[model samples]
Target: MMTRAYIFLNGVGEKEEFYKKLDFKNSSVYCADGGYRQCLKAGAIPKEVWGDFDSVSDSEFKDLEDSDIILRKFSKEKDSTDGELLIEYVSSKNYDEIYVLCGLGGRLDHELTNINLLFKYKNINIKTEKELLFSVDRKYTFINKKNKIISFVPFSDEVRNMNLKGFKYPLNDYLLKRGDSRCMSNIVCSDEATVDFNTGRLLCILND
Candidate 1:
């Protein structure tokens, strides 16, 4: 398997089992400031930790200080979120994929913004206890979706010529928009299913 950069965002303790199920082999762990505390709680060592120490408690920061990990601190008054900064840094590392943990289920605006960050990379997957979300800029295929129902959401204003094969509710070159629900809750009929789009990006989510 290709190595993955695991991003530890805030709200790390929201789902314990999900973090436990994360595959860490050949993966470097990066924590976004306060998420480092959650990393310690999960008993995972972070290779690098970055962010302003605002959200992190004083004791937690001290805990990190006691460790010998690479720490990069920034002022609270920053241009971008800590998660975004870490993502950019990880992108530069040329990892095969970026797996984001605890990026969801936060403040409403923050959660939505985190989802938007999926567009930042072509090979990023956001995992939470409730769902597994990833973006599809061109085409994506999933095997073992025989009896599974996945949600196809258009990230942009419209994703033109969206097509799905081996699905119960097959869509051939269908147009999907932000408000369209036709593609939602589509059932997969075959062992191997495909979702392809000619132009634009969309989000695919498999409910847990």
Candidate 2:
């Protein structure tokens, strides 16, 4: 039952450092279209490449095809974004953990959409940078921030039974609504912090 899933993004000007942090040997890597270029540059091959060939170059696609990487091409006239499509594909598999690299620092709209996808999938621990984000049914927690800022915002209805520990402004049985600023700008007071939401979708942001 080892953790075995990864998603790589190949947007414009992705940093090389992030790819170095990944353990490609054991994880099943997936790319979002042009992401295959970044995978090859990192000396890692993807198990599947999912997206419209819009951002992918012809030579790159040919190379991937030659390399035996499975390409799940979608039409340019599709509903879900390529990243979202990849997420759905992985959700069908029984992976314990999913790491997303080259996901941040891309288009602003894509970044926002990727963050929202966190709420759609549970059971699998999704991590980016050094932050781990996951939800247990209705509750979500962000951890592994050594000295970082963790902020929470309710994405659905008001969040209830909110509790915070190991933070500068600890909360006890607090209720957070859409317009509440009580959970903003909270710093990690310990090696790690925990944020639990009882009944709502929350966008838990962790900054290093």
Tens digits of per-residue lDDT, candidate 2, 1-208, equal 5967878776543346756777888889898887777678877878999989898888877887787778888899989998888988787787877766666656889876776777787544445555554444555444565557777777766888888888889999888888888887788877666777677777765654
> Looking at model 1, which ten-residue stretch has the lowest summed lDDT?
11-20
TM-score of model 1 (CA atoms): 0.93
lDDT at 207, model 1: 73
Q: What's the TM-score of each model vs. the native?
A: 0.93, 0.83
Tell me how far the alpha carbon of residue 96 in candidate 2 is from the true structure, in angstroms, after superposition.
1.2
- Residue-level lDDT tens digits of model 1 in 78-110: 899998898888877888888787787667776
Query: CA lDDT of 66 in candidate 2?
Result: 85
TM-score of model number 2: 0.83
* Stretch of 10 with least lDDT, candidate 2: 133-142
lDDT values for all models: 0.82, 0.74
The top-ranked prediction according to lDDT is 1
